[model samples]
Target: MKKIRIFIIDDHKLFVEGISSLLSDDPRFEIVGHALSGNELLSKFTELDLDIFLIDINMPEISGVELTRQIKKLNPKANILALTMYDDYSYVEKMIKSGAAGYVLKSANLSELSKAIEIVASGKKYFGEEIQEMVYNKISGKAAFDDKRPSMNELSLTKREIEILSLIVQEYTTQQIAEKLFISERTVETHRKNIFSKTKVKSAIGLSKFAFQHGIIDFK
Candidate 1:
């Protein structure tokens, strides 16, 4: 079996060592390298081949957000995952925009951490339940419209599009949404493409923000 090569970056040595020890035992993951700072990681960039990078958002210098942007510049295809204690929506948004494939709290269990690595390594996005909830709550509290209220007719979202947006806001994966709506996953993806085009957002996280801002989904 081919093992996924992993690199960890954080300011805390103990956290780095602990994660190294934990993942060293997992057959599916190979710890290729680790760094205590973004500068350290960049210095040895040419020396390591990594499939996934576990990054801490809060660092003394070159914060995870900036590091993620640099890493993407080094290798645009790199799969970056933010593993930190921060649950704030701004942090999550910034990290995602910086090219991170996933975000999970440091307090996450071994299973969730491993799952996040697998998901991101496979080119899929993963946001832990807690992170998702934090985003949902943050979006929910804001009014759907500002002084310039977009008329429903101007928004031009079809009924099916609205349904898919609601499911997306509820944190349903494309496959799950397909199953729930009794449609092919490809069809669901097509709808998502349309939704993004109509909303002018690039990611699911962006979609959630748009959904809340347009009152596409109700808070419960």
Candidate 2:
């Protein structure tokens, strides 16, 4: 049985040490490394063979959104599982847009955390029940937040672009989208940028909103 190799990045030293110790007791997990900040993690990012990254959202210098984006750019195969105290729906949407595979609240028990890790490791997205409810509520427009409306460009989504748009909203990573669509990753990226431009919504969160507004994707 292969152990799930994990790398942790959190600003709190006590949390890092505690989680590392607790994870060490689990025979299925191997905590290969940890860092106290995003910069520190980037410095040693190339040094490890990690399966899942446990990232904290509110770091001092680089926020988890940017960190997760950078990590995905650095290692497209990197599977990020956000481990943060924040339960904000916006944060969850941002992290998913930034290429994180899952989101786990810091409040999660050992069993839930382990389950989240396993789900993400198997190439599926995971979110806590509470977080899921929050996202669903926001998407259904039961909750209020500013939705960045996209400019209705003269150009509209092509059939291919719509397909990609749906997959992107579903939180499929670029690589996975490429595989599923039977296209090159570069092609998938090009289509993604085109969708962004045509919809004039750069953020995936906003793009999903655009999709929902246009009936391209159902909010439900």
Q: How high is the CA lDDT of each candidate model?
A: 0.81, 0.79
Q: Lowest summed-lDDT stretch of 10 residues in model 1? A: 143-152
Give candidate 2 misplaced runs (Cα > 4 Å).
143-220
Q: How close is candidate 1 to the true structure, as a TM-score?
A: 0.64
lDDT of 2 by residue, 1-220 (tens): 9999989897765456656767788899999999888899999888889789989898878988999999999999888999876778889989999999999776555778889988887778899766786777888977743332333343366778878887877678999999999999999999988989877875776664455344344221
lDDT of 1 by residue, 36-146 (tens): 899999999988887999999888679999999999999999999998867678999999999999998765567788999999998899998777767777789853222
Report the poorest 10 consecutive residues by lDDT, candidate 2: 146-155
Clashes per model (N, Cα, C within 3 A): 0, 0
TM-scores for every candidate against the unseen true structure: 0.64, 0.64
Q: Report the Cα lDDT for residue 154, model 1.
A: 71
